[model samples]
Target chain A: MKSVLCILFTFGLWLLLTWSLDPKVVGVGLMMAILVATLLAHIYPDNPHKALDPRRWFWACIYFPYFLVLCIKSNLDVAYRVLHPDLPIRPGIVKIRTRLTSEMAKTFLANSITLTPGTMTVDIVGQDLYIHWINVHGVDAEEHTRRIVRPFEGLLRRVFE
Target chain B: MSETIAQWIIGVGLMFDLLGCLGLVRLPDVYNRLQAGTKCVTLGTCMIMFGTFLYGVAALDRPQMAVQALLCAVFVLLTSPVAAHAIARGAYRAGARLWEGSVIDRLGEDLHGVRPPAERAEPADQPAAVHHFTESES
Candidate 1:
């Protein structure tokens, strides 16, 4: 069932890419989508009906906009620093901890940090994430966690783990 | 009016791209350059694509072109940071030097030499100690 949905979704994207309703184009796209989906379906096997919880979907929708706002804010922040005459950046690699247990949630947190203002996630060894902070505020891990990781941690935890 | 808006968006994107290039030239180290290059370029390219999307939809009345522009924007958003991550990892492993003024070098110490667990002593008062993996005996 999930495979079928995946095929349909891919086929829809194919159609969108071609922007054509012509039967011949669609027929070729359908074959390609089916071939790709069947080959990859086992990798993403559904978890026995547990994946359809609407609450998670709602949180994901909310996450997108919240993340979008963060991205815009971060872009502006970086832009300001770049254009500043003194270039007030104080770059350093700092280690901070995350309470996120799931790998997926940690990934989301890392990517979010990279995209946000003055921070880039360099490496993650265990729960300790080494971030290249363009501006090093302080050395206190607890303080850094509060300012950086805590904001998205709750939302991601709710959505993923 | 719609065309003007699209042009303005494209202009904003160009400004970002220009600033990003400036950053690449002006920033002190590889990590800082990556920060400027990755974030600014990603946002700039995505913005330009988005401007194209808006222009196609509103000014040209062509949904096909608009969709392609949107797809390009989405693809850039998804892939740019991953590229940045790989570059950063490679740079660090290859011994790319940080700026002379850098305050902390946690990864440098951990990967190049070991900091005994005692030096990295966590706040024992926290309940999350058990979940924390002590420094792997390198």
Candidate 2:
């Protein structure tokens, strides 16, 4: 019963985010969503632990605005560095110690870091997140990676595990 | 001011993408280089798409171009990290060693006992401590 609801919800969200908003689009989207949901249910559907958590959803709702602001800000920073005569770039890969225990949190952190500019999570070894930082600013690139990935971890923990 | 700001944003995004490409070529390790390629290119391309979107809105007045730009942005958002993960996992599976300066390898000693290729062929006589997966999975 809950699985059906989850599938419907997931499909609905997918439909909403797609290109069209018309009734035909919505109807097609709904059918596609159901197919996807049903396929997902068959694949690995029985984890009650993956259920909805209000706190996580609340954080997710707010996180987007924060991400947008950072996206714009990072764009400006990268542009400035690009145009500047100095050509500021300290290229290096750094390993960050991840404290999150849950797999979902770690995955969230990994994806979120990639979402933001200037850093990418290239490798994850257990709780250690190996990141490639484009411009190694200030003293601690490792610390910077940790600081950026930290928020996503918290919200992911609340939601998934 | 707004026009200048928009120009600055587009220019910077392009710069970062350029830097990212340079780093991907210049960096020492696969992991390090992948980072440059993934984040920098993804953001840089995104900026270009966004600039196009802005131009579409302010200049051409075409909704289709803006929509296409947005679709590109969404596509980048979804695939960049996934590609990174695939690269990292492929590297690991192919036995690429982690950096020495790394502070910790939480995977170190925690595998269901999967050993490196070199260590795997040691000896059947060696006890459970360095347990071999081949012998056990059978």
Candidate 3:
């Protein structure tokens, strides 16, 4: 019941986001989301075959909105750089460590970083993460990761672990 | 009911977007700024987009633009936070610190092999280690 609700919630948000009142288009999108989500469920089915983490979903709902705001801000920042005379890109790669025990949270975090603009998740070494950034304030790994992650930890704590 | 109202909404939305950008520039560090950039700015842009959607309805029949703009918003919604998470994780892996100034890392107790309630039911942490990366250490 919970997993099914999760799928429905995901579908509803997606539909609202698309903002297409065109029933045909929305219906199609909803159907697609359901199909993929259901298939995913089967691939990791309930009980003995699969385990569902409602906490992760809860965290996902909480964390996702905040990330959206960051995206918009970053998008504008990048746009400014493009529009301005100086591109001001100070690209470099750095390494950092994590306290996240579950590989699931780590992987989600990795992929999240990649999706954001001007930053990339290069690799993961155990609990450590390797990132290529468009800029660096200093050479300290702990400081940098802390800045990047403070927004995420609470919701993530509720989520993928 | 009037163009003036639409104009006001649009202006407010733009201001929200602008304030977010300012936060991005002024915030102390990457992660802090990511908060300013991601949360405040995201709200600003969404508001701006929403105003435009309304304006389209009042001025022209460009509902398509509104819908498409909405779709763009959706894509951003699904992906942005995940991206931040990814970048944070990446930065952490790559040696970015939270702050030289902060004291508590709550994760310390949770991490020292103390499993979360979510993973405690089964003998969970049993995935085969992907590799022995000692050779890669310099």
Q: Name the candidate that leads on DockQ.
A: 1
TM-scores vs. true structure, each candidate: 0.82, 0.57, 0.45
How many angstroms is residue B107 displaced in model 2 relative to the true structure, after the best TM-score fit? 4.8
Question: What does the TM-score come to for chain B in model 3?
Answer: 0.67
lDDT of 3 by residue, A1-161 (tens): 64575577667766666766788977887787777676676543234222366655666777777776666556665555434444355544456677776656676676556545555555566877655565565657778787666566666667754
DockQ of 3: 0.06
> Which 10 successive residues of model 3 chain B have the least lDDT summed?
B129-138
Error at B116, model 3, angstroms: 41
Q: How close is candidate 3 to the true structure, as a TM-score?
A: 0.45
Which digits, one per residue and each the tens of the lDDT, describe model 2 over residues A1-161? 65576667766566545656788878877787777766776544346545565676787777767776765565555445444555455544456776677665666678777656666675677777766555655456466645666656666665666
Error of 3 at A36 (Å): 3.5
Model 1, C-alpha of B64: deviation from truth (Å): 0.8
- Give the C-alpha miss distance for residue A123 in model 1, angstroms: 1.3
Clashes of each: 0, 1, 38
Sorted into a CAPRI-style docking class, model 2 comes out as incorrect
- Point out the higher-scoring one by DockQ: 1 or 3: 1
Docking quality category of candidate 1 according to DockQ thresholds? medium
How does each model score on lDDT?
0.81, 0.62, 0.56
Q: What lDDT score goes with residue B1 in model 3?
A: 72
Error of 2 at A14 (Å): 9.9
lDDT of 1 by residue, A21-60 (tens): 9999999999999998988877553453435877777888
